[model samples]
Target: MTNAEANSGKKAVIFNVQRYSTEDGPGVRTTVFFKGCPLSCLWCSNPESQQAKPQMMYFSKTCVQCYACVKACPNGANKIKDDGSVWVDRSVCTNCGVCVKVCLADARSMSGKKMTVDEVFDIIQKDSLYYINSGGGVTLGGGECTTEPEFVGELLDRCYDRAIHTCIDTCGYTPWSVLEKILPKVELVLFDIKHMDTEKHKELTGVGNELILENAVKIKQMGTRMIIRLPLIPGYNDDENNIKVMGWFMESWGMDRIDILPYHRLGENKYDALGMNYSLGDLPNLAKDSISRAVKILGSYGLEVHVM
Candidate 1:
């Protein structure tokens, strides 16, 4: 039986399958972003990915005030307030996606969809020529792919069988047993490290970094190719103390490559559409000088620094 045939019963709630992406991994890649997460980071760009189930997102600016959604919603979830703003009643909303269908401006959408391994695999295989010529393949990312270990493992196993390079973009906040099963098939791991300090880590991201830090050590020992991705947030992890500690940790773990992702406000609008509050209100992007300083500090530990 094929990999998909063996895992036919398994399905994962995925938010997006971004195609022709070069930044996610080596060469060109198709990033499969799954829904569900353990960590609620203060600066998460993809707020829609945090939830396990499907969510209705409304882009207020693009809405044409067609009122089609108001008439279509059986639960009266979509309403227009007296101020001419769209209001979504989460308490009454079943997330049945009725309102999303009637959105004339293409402003409303459901964030997640359930897909079987075969369904997603068909899409991945369609880009085989791109993966072959460009030395890239598939990237399984989150909310946290490990949250749905069985489905992700089976999918990655399929990639391994086909000799297509596979990578995982993860936060590393998962049980070792999960990675133990999936890492063997993954050619590269884009491990995200938010903060080195455990207390500060918890304060910023909802969970402590003990497990994440430990997993980094284990992943290195497993002889799997991995890169440390640090999303450098201004006035947060860019402090000298944090940078120094991260460098020390990198050296201790024998991890040399580090990708510096300067913070941006790209996802701010998503929070509004999702009717969720963004914790970091109006935080500006990381300055060029701060990025340079971080690069210098990490480079002090002899890391192969790549600014993304």
Candidate 2:
């Protein structure tokens, strides 16, 4: 089959298409958040990203008490409790997204939708001028973007044709074959290192780090530029050992730049909105000195670290 026939027509459930994002990669970027991730991290900020299917997200604060959803929901899933709190009756709500359309206050929304390569590319290319001026381009992120390899690869292929810089913010948990197909079109790989020890990694992220580490090596072998991203969860992986080990791993790979993504409670409310239990809900906000401390430790190890 031709490249067009091979990768086209496949649809992936994407949760968000953030425009003018400076954090996903260098310069300006359009971050595509694909839904569905194989690994479940204890402190995942994007709980809505975990599921591949379309899901509902309710913002109770945004509700104007219009009760439009109450009239539109075919399943009677929208209701006002005795205390006057309007919310989706998630128990009976099928997440068909029917009520989201009728939500007058923009309080109700769906997190995922099926999109072909062309649809997503349309959004990406609209920012082409920004990409050209800022050395920025597209970054395919997740839930776990690689879960839909064919679709993502095709998107990258299209970006390549347009001369757009392409990258992926990946957990590195998927198979090498999955990444192998897409890496060719990827200019940078933002590889995340949740924890160094395999058992500890599994304990924190619901998956071992073997595949992730191996994928790092494979990507390096392919000569793809990479920026190692480490989320510094204060009480979790901020220990000296984990930091040193991560630094050493980078040192081993002859890598220099590592981005430390500080932990935050931003996604905590998102969990409640999605009717999911956030395991780290009780964890305090990351200490003010956490990132600085990590930078000191990694810098001492001769690894360049920057806080994102």
Candidate 3:
């Protein structure tokens, strides 16, 4: 298809465009967080990213009980309670963004926006100098980058056409056909391996690990540069046995590098904002020893290990 045709009628709902992120890829890079995900991971940090469409976010701390949203909402979704605190009836809220646009305290906010390929590229091109100098480029990530294959494919194609390095941060829950479409344009793959066991993986992520596991091998076969990432949720996938099995799987697949991402309560507040329960409630950050031990286990298999 022609570039113009590819750009036409193609748009994705993106929740964030994080610039100068050091951890997403190499050097200074922009991480485009696509909205919507198939898997509902127990410890999702960006809870707002779960939906495919735009959503509302309320910061109660900044609300002054002025009932501005109450008056602005067409659905009467916003309400002022007895204690003079503002309460948002998310059930009735349509996320019209009317309340968000009028709120001056930066409390009421919308999470995602629709953007065409060219529109998104306009923002990406702003950092062309940094990307060129620092060997950094664009990275498409969660809720799952592969969720919108065409949009992501076109975006990555554009980046590659500009001689910019590209990456995809994926949960590996999507079909291999989707990954096949994305891998050719992606220079690096930051693939998340949530769990090794099927039932346990299903329990934590609402999906079995079969497809994810299958795709990991396919990714390796495709000869894509991939770094396996483990979320390291304590009392879940962080057990020594799971780590050993993961290490064995990587070794069996000749996957040499792994990054251990320790779990944190960072998403707890986001759950509150979205009015959702945090599955890993009150779970402390993965202890340093756990991190070190995980590294040692993977390293023992002659694999390069990192605590990212």
Candidate 4:
């Protein structure tokens, strides 16, 4: 079933509604982060978003030893250890939010929430003055905004009706039809290019670049403004050869601009909270020199490059 069909109730699963964002798009904007993603990027910052369902997150430091969660859990997922600290068995936990509901110390929480299109717009509308003043509106990001194409489409349509500028921050790993449905309402598309080499792209992001590349061309042909974003991961896609290949793609495809995002450990603690192992443990952030080198290459291709 399509994302919208699965959510026929007209509600989409989202994790966050961040406001006053300057990086996502043109002006002061609100970014709605959806849950679920098809790719398993090794350096995923938002590890909690990879799952399409609501997930429980634990903060051990906040536990007050009230044992409320242990008493509230129906699945016996919460256990009191000999040290008086509770351990959560994620496998047994159904993510029913029972523990979160009973947690007095706010230690346990759920990541995703279901909200209707109008409900999301209500929050966006509060920032309407900011959007109009800054030329920024709302940006639908992921887990892959296209995963909920119908919901996002409806949200974008409403924004357009209100004259709010729209943007979608995507990985371009979705079906073209899904994108086609939303593009009419989207003013800008923040498309990601993980790797130009097909096999390398698959190895890093768990998918080939053929479909993504094809969609990039299709998006351009659809008359949508697009920006190519590259997540600069050290010792991965930041190599000279890979950067050269990426530059060539921009030049050949006539992409107007590119955004190079330096990889960082900003999301490392998130994996711990989600009870997942971080693939790139303690990896250093991409150096300024490397970013400059990449900028030079893309500049040689006559493409506008911005480090985000």
TM-score of each: 0.97, 0.93, 0.96, 0.94
**Model 2 misplaced stretches (Cα beyond 4 Å):** 1-7
Per-candidate alpha-carbon RMSD to the true structure = 1.2, 2.1, 1.6, 3.3
Tens-digit per-residue lDDT, 26-72, candidate 4: 99999999999999899999988899898999888889999988988
Write down the lDDT of every candidate, Cα atoms only. Answer: 0.91, 0.89, 0.87, 0.89
**Regions of candidate 3 where Cα sits further than 4 Å from its true position:** 1-6
Candidate 3 has a TM-score of 0.96
Worst 10 residues of 3 by lDDT: 1-10
Model 3 lDDT at residue 121: 79
Error of 1 at 145 (Å): 0.7
Best by TM-score: 1
lDDT of 1 by residue, 28-145 (tens): 8889999999999999999999999999988899988888999999998888989777888888988899988888789899999999888888888888889999999999997998
Please report how far candidate 2 places residue 40 from its true position, in Å.
2.1
Q: Rank the candidates by TM-score, best first.
A: 1, 3, 4, 2
Best by lDDT: 1
Candidate 1 positional error at 184, Å:
1.0
